[model samples]
Target: MTQFEINSDISVARCLSPSFYLDDVYFESSRDHIFSRTWQFAGLKSDADNIRPVTLLEGFLDEPLIVTYDGELRCFSNVCTHRGNLLVSESCRGASIRCGYHGRKFDLSGKFLSMPEFEGVRDFPGPEDDLAGLEIREVAGLMFVAFDPAGSFEEFFGPTLGRLADFENSNTAVSTSVYEVNAHWALYCENYLEGFHIPYVHKSLNRELDFASYDIRTFRFSSLQTAVPAELEKDSGRRQEFDGKAAFYYFVFPNLMFNFYPWGLSVNVVEPLSPTRTRVRYVTLETDPSKRKTGAGSDLERVEAEDQRIVESVQKGIGSRLYKPGRYSVKQEIGTHHFHRLIAEFMNQGGAR
Candidate 1:
C-alpha cells in the first residue's frame, strides 16, 4: 500500500475522491488510521476536580475513561482489570477506585491496590493488573485525551490554543449541544473550511462581515479564516475595544473548530457515527455578555441551520453517479484543500490511495 500524496500546489490539485465520504469500509478504516491516532476532547479540566467517568466518543470510539484529582489530576481507563467493570460510574471525589463486580481496587493514579480473597495466589500482582493510564493533557482549562496519539499536544493544536492564551482564561459557562445529522462528518467539516458559501447561503451573516476581505490562512495542522466586519472595515475606531476588527475562525485537523468572536469562543467537535451519520457538538464560552448578539458570531443557530441544509444536500449530490471529482477554487477553498490533503495522507496509510 502506497501513501496517499497530495499535490503541494493547490492550483492543479483535484478535490478528494467522493468515495472517501461514501464508502463504509473507508469510514471504518478511519477509526484507527485517523480518530484513534488523534487527540480528542474529554470534557473540561474541571471534570477531573472530582473523579468522574467520562466516555470518549460515546457513540463511536466509545472508550470508557475517567479522571481523578489526587492533589494532581490524572486520566486512566475506567475499566477494572480483575473483571470488566466500570470503576467510577459517576462524578465524586474518591480516595480509590473500586470495581463492584469483584471488589478489585486501584488507587487514584490507577496503581493496583489490594484485592479480596487473593491471599494464596501466586504472582499476586503484576503490571497488567494496574489500570491503564492514557495520554491526557490540559490546555486552556480543557481536557484532551488520546489513545495511541500520533504526536505531542503542541503538534496537534499549537496554533489555535497558542493564539488564545493572551485573550482568554478559564472556560466559563460552556453551552453544549449534541445531535446526529445525516451526512458524512468530513462533509460537514469541509463546509466549515471555507467562507465561500457565506455570502450565498447565510443571508443574515452576509450583512455582518466584509466578505471581500475574508481570507483563509493555513497552519501546520490547522487553518485560520478571518472575517473583517463591514462596519469595522468602514470605521476601524469603532471596534477598538474587541480583539481585532475581524472574527477568527480556526479549524483543527480531523474535527475541531475554535471560533473566536468579541464575545468569546465557540468550540465545535465533530463525531462520526457512520458513513452517512455524524454527531456534532457546539461548546460556547462567553467572556463578554455585551457582545453576544452582535457582529460575525451572532445568530449562530440560524447560520448552523443553513449549513445543515446545504451540507446534507451536498451529501446527496456527491452520491449521484453523474457527479465526478471537482476542482478547488484556489482563492477561496485553500482550507478545504489542506483538509483533503491530510485526509488523503491518513487514508492512504496501511492501504493504497
Candidate 2:
C-alpha cells in the first residue's frame, strides 16, 4: 500500500493517491462517475455534412453512438433492438438507418420505422423496442454526447466552454493532421492540466514561453493555463496581435482540452480503452492556413512527443510501490488539485461504478 499526505500550507489541495491511477477497481468506478457523466466530444458538425444531414459517430466510451440531423439534431445508441446487432457499421447518408443483419429500419429520430420479418409478433413496435436515446449537445460546430441523461453539457463544461465561445464560433477548418495517441487517457489529461512539467519535459517549448509568467486559473469543473511570450509579459497592451504570443489552454472537466494559440486552436478528446490504456484524439481548428505553424505551438509533433514521454513515465512511476499521493505546488498545480477534487466529489455521489 502507498502512503498519502496532504499539505495544508498550500492554498490548493494535493492530488489523489497512486492507487487511484493503478487500481483496476478505481478505474472501473471512474468510468461511470467521470467518463459517462461528463460530456464527450463526439465529432465535428462537418462530419454530418458528408452523410448529408445524418452521420453516425462510432466508439464513444466503448459504446457505439450515432448522431443524425434531419430537421433537428439527435443521437441514439447504435445497437439494434432485435438480436443486438450494431445498427450503423459505417457512416452513411440516407433517409433512415437500417440494420444490415435483420433489415430492422429506424428513422433519423431513432423511432422504429419497420421490421421486415416480425409481422406476427405482438407489441412489435412498443416504446421499449425503440433504440435507446443518448443526450446530444453542440457548442459552435463541435458535437458532444453523454450516456447519462441526467448530465447537462452546460453544467459539466461550466465556464470552460463559455470562455472559448468566441474561438468555437470562428470560421475555422478542421486540420488534416488528426493525431491519435495511445496512452492512459487520465495521464494525458493530467499532463494537460498543469504547466509545472513544461520546463523539465519540454525544452524547446520553454524557449518560446516565459515559464515565470505562465498563469493558471481554476474554475468549477475545469481550469485554464495561459502562456505569454517573455517579451510580451510586461506590455499588457500588446496582447491581441496576430504575431503577439498567447496560448489559452482549457481543460473541461473529465476529458476534453481546448487549446487556443495565436495561430488557431486545437481540441483534444481523451477516450479510455481499459484500466491502463487510452486514446488521445487531436482535432485542429484554424481559419488562417499560414498561421497554423506559428509560435512555440507551431512544432506540434515535437511538443506532442515531449508530452507523451513524460506522461507515460509518470504512469509507470504511479504503479510503483514507492509511489504515493503527492503534494501540489500551490502556485503551479492548482488546476490538478481542482480536477482531483471533482473526481472525489463525483465518486462520493455514487456516480462512480
Candidate 3:
C-alpha cells in the first residue's frame, strides 16, 4: 500500500527505491498498476492466423486472448462465456470460435452466435453470453493489445512511427530469442536507459560507439537514445546513409524496448515471473541482410551477456542491508531519471481499470 515518489529534479532525485524492486507487494501490485494499463506486444500480424490464441504478458498478466481476422483483425477473451472454458487453444483458420468444452460458439468478431442445448433456457444467449472484446493497435506489421490502456497507441508509439516505417516492414526477416535473468525487471531496464556504464561494462561496444555523442530524448510515454558510430565505423561507410547514427534504442514505459539498428529492429519485452526473476524476449527483425553483422547491433549476444552479468550483480547488491537508493548523474542519466519518475507516477495511481 506504500506510494512511491521520485524527485522531479535530476540534480537531487534519487534512483527508484530498492523496495520497488525488492518487495513482493510492489511486484504483485504492478501487474495491474503498471503492466495492465500499458500497451503490450501481442504478436506479428503477419504471423497471426484467422484465429490465433495469445496470452497477454505471458507469465505476468496471462490474460488468455484470441486474435481473429475476418475482414479485419480483432481481439477477444479466449475464455468462453458459458462456463469459462478456454475458447481457442491455438492458431487455426476459422470463421467462428467453438468452445470444445460446452459446445458454445461465437463469431470472429466475438458476437454470440449460438449455444447448443440452450433452446429453452431462460434469458438465453443475451449480450452477456457474447465474448468480451479488447482493443488492439497495429504498428508496422506488429500487433499490440491492451485490456485498459492509460493512453492512446499513438501517444505511446507515435514519436517513432515516422522513423520506424522506413526500417520495419513486411519484407523484414523476423526472429526471436529469449533470456531469463535472475534480477528484477527494473534493474535490466534502468541499465538500458543510460549509456553511462558502457565504458565500464562493455569494452567492445564502447569501442564501436562514440560515447561522447550518445544522446537521450524523453517523450511522454517513451524515451529514445541514439548512439553515434565510432569514427572507424563512419570511415568504413557503414553508417553513411544514417547520417552518423548507429543505433536507435527506444524504451516504452513499463517494459518494452524497440532497438533499431542498421540491420533491423530488436524488441525486448520484459516479463516478470517473480520478484527476483524476469524474462526478456528479444524479437529481432532483419531489414538489411548485408548490415546484420555491422555496427552497434552486430555484437548483441556479447553485449547482452555483459549486461546480464552486471545487472544480476546489482540485483544481489540492492538486497544488502547497508545499501540505499543512489542519486542519478544529471548529465548522464536523464533517461533513467525519466523512467523512475514514470514508474512512481504509474505505481501511485488508483486501482487498475
lDDT of each: 0.83, 0.72, 0.86
Q: Give candidate 3's whole-model lDDT.
A: 0.86
lDDT of 1: 0.83
Better of 2 and 3 by lDDT: 3
Most lDDT-accurate candidate: 3
Compute the lDDT of residue 140 as modeled in candidate 3: 70
TM-score-based ranking, best first? 3, 1, 2
Q: Candidate 2: list runs displaced more than 4 Å.
A: 1-12, 47-60, 117-120, 149-151, 167-169, 176-183, 233-237, 242-245
Can you write out model 2's per-residue Cα lDDT over 114-195, one digit (the tens) per residue? 8887878886689977889878887777888777723467666767676567766587777535444445667778778888
Residue-wise C-alpha lDDT for candidate 1, range 44-154, written one tens digit per residue? 767444788899987788899988876677889998898788887889866887888889989989999989999988997999999989988776667788777666777
Give TM per candidate: 0.94, 0.86, 0.95
Candidate 3 regions off by >4 Å?
A: 167-170, 232-239, 350-353
* Superposition TM-score, candidate 3 onto the true structure: 0.95
Candidate 3, run of 10 with poorest lDDT: 232-241
lDDT of the structure predicted as candidate 2: 0.72
Candidate 2 clash pair list: none
Whose TM-score is higher: candidate 2's or candidate 3's?
Answer: 3
